[model samples]
Target: MSQAKKIMNDPENLVDETLDGLVAISNGLLAREPGSRVVRSTKIEQGKVGLLVGGGSGHEPMYGAFVGPGLANASVSGDIFAAPAPQHVQEAIEAADAGAGVLIVYGNYAGDVMNFDMGAETAEEDSDIESKTVLVRDDVATDDYEGRRGIGGAFYVVKAAGAACAKGMSLEEAAEVTERVQYNTRTIGVAVRAGILPDTGKRTFELGDDEMEIGLGMHGEVGVERSKMMTADEVAKKMVDMVADDLPYESGDRVAVYINNLGATTQMELLIVYRKVAELLAERGLKVERTDIGAHFTSQDMAGFSLTLLKLTDEIAELIDAPCESVPFTQG
Candidate 1:
């Protein structure tokens, strides 16, 4: 019944303003096209398979923050909770294109799929630049695996693909690695609170004070179940079980345990969740190869966390170890 408090000056300019901030903070590592919304990395190497990731703007540090050496070559953003236009997507493709080919990665949202597909087609039609698409459907909140939403789990998918390209893999090969990682990854999230939509200035979803959402998506859609609040260990146990069982990760499988803060969940809270997650994985004999306990893909101001299990084959592990440098993220 009241205006949602937002710090931005205008909702209409939020996306562009956000891009401006990203470019500024990047300190010469990233740049925005002249009068265009495509944010490209200034550090893209010459003659490698171009890597591009695009989606709506609300999920900060994802699809955009991912641009740099060893990650996405470019990223295009749409308005708040919306997909980028085809033209913008095409511009991103052009920015990413360095001759070999381009590999497009995004969540399985229909708008993203359509826009990215059209963008790829336009690139080929206009400039003869070949490209491939890898759709991420790693969220196991739904029974239909193929129809699942791409959540925080997409981070590793991008990492693997970017590393593959950085390692001199072909477009087709990098695309394959991207898809393989997507399939091997699974995620499940729980939100104890909702995020505010800058466009609407309202909470993305509603929850009673004593309630928590299970299997919540980044978009703030109602989760699969709503239950009274649970302790950190209880929540972690429930979420870890759901994610691990859906992927059917076995006793001997090596995995990277990722704990993603939806938006506002605190460090202390997530680390506690990770503790139980790690203990559970050990009990199941699943080898923990790495643990990523921080924000990768976030929904603005949403107080929750998502757990991602990236089953690491030797290949995925090697790719994960490759060096990458982005303003907000860097790894080796």
Candidate 2:
């Protein structure tokens, strides 16, 4: 059977029911819009820039989960692996905006770009909110010079932009910082197996035993090329080298590293990637000032991982560390 029926009602109810459960456990920090899954910013303050981010639904702890003081003001949740509607994006922006304008920082998918552009238009026409967008196209697997896709590096971009907004930076400034991070960062991923969509209960793609797809996107989009699996060290070198070549960083360039888990990948595997990747950066004379390893971004239950490196500057460093207190985030 391609699709297996679930125990708790229809598969279509999974997303909404899961969100309802989240709001209950959130201690009132998260509020969903009536008739929509989009989470709104109840903590928005006047004269502060609003930040909005969203995409498909499979990536947990993203879109809505990250909404808090040091993160996104609001995040519009869409269906599993499907982009959210433009109205949801607009609602998120309007709810988060407090007259200081709004910034939409999201992945670089074509649907996201088109829908957010429409949301910006709605914000301009329906309200006094000035909106700007920063597309996160950090995936090095796709041609950066061409129509590149977005991937796990979105976590860093979100962190950087949210920190800036919390520091009272204007929408333009926050967007600028996000754009800078997007330009400085690059990501590449490898997948051992495909994910099974909850609604369908079947694999989105096929993969043979011991096979790995290099440069895979978050959604299992066709990557650089399918190849025989290699050793952890070999895979790390290939992924890191691609990023290094894509950016113009040289010796002494400071960077922050993020090793993302694309769902179902064990922490052990991620650590292996991180360890080998760090060695490559060290040999290149790159200074990795900080590192984050987690499933900050995901593609459902895909057993894969992505490596992201953001060349850092003093301004961005401070911006990323600035304090904010939100439901999902806390400051030192």
Best by TM-score: 1
lDDT against the true structure, each candidate: 0.89, 0.81
Q: Write the per-residue lDDT of candidate 1 for residues 1-332, one digit (tens) a residue.
A: 56668788877888888999999999899999656779998988888998999899899989777999999999999888789999998889999998899999999998888888998899899988999999989888889987889999888899888898888889989998888989999999999889999888789889999999999888887678899999999998888889889879999999998888888988999888888889999998999989887777889999999999999999999998789999777986
Off by over 4 Å in 1: 1-3
Q: Report how far residue 178 has shifted in candidate 2, in Å.
A: 1.4
Model 2 root mean square deviation, Cα atoms: 2.0
Kindly list the per-residue Cα lDDT of model 2 for residues 104-146, writing each as its tens digit: 8888788888888887798789886898888888888766444
On a 0 to 100 scale, what is the lDDT of residue 24 in model 1? 92
Each prediction's TM-score versus the true structure = 0.98, 0.94
Which ten contiguous residues of candidate 1 have the minimum total lDDT?
A: 1-10
Clashing pairs in 1: none
Output the number of the lDDT-best candidate.
Answer: 1
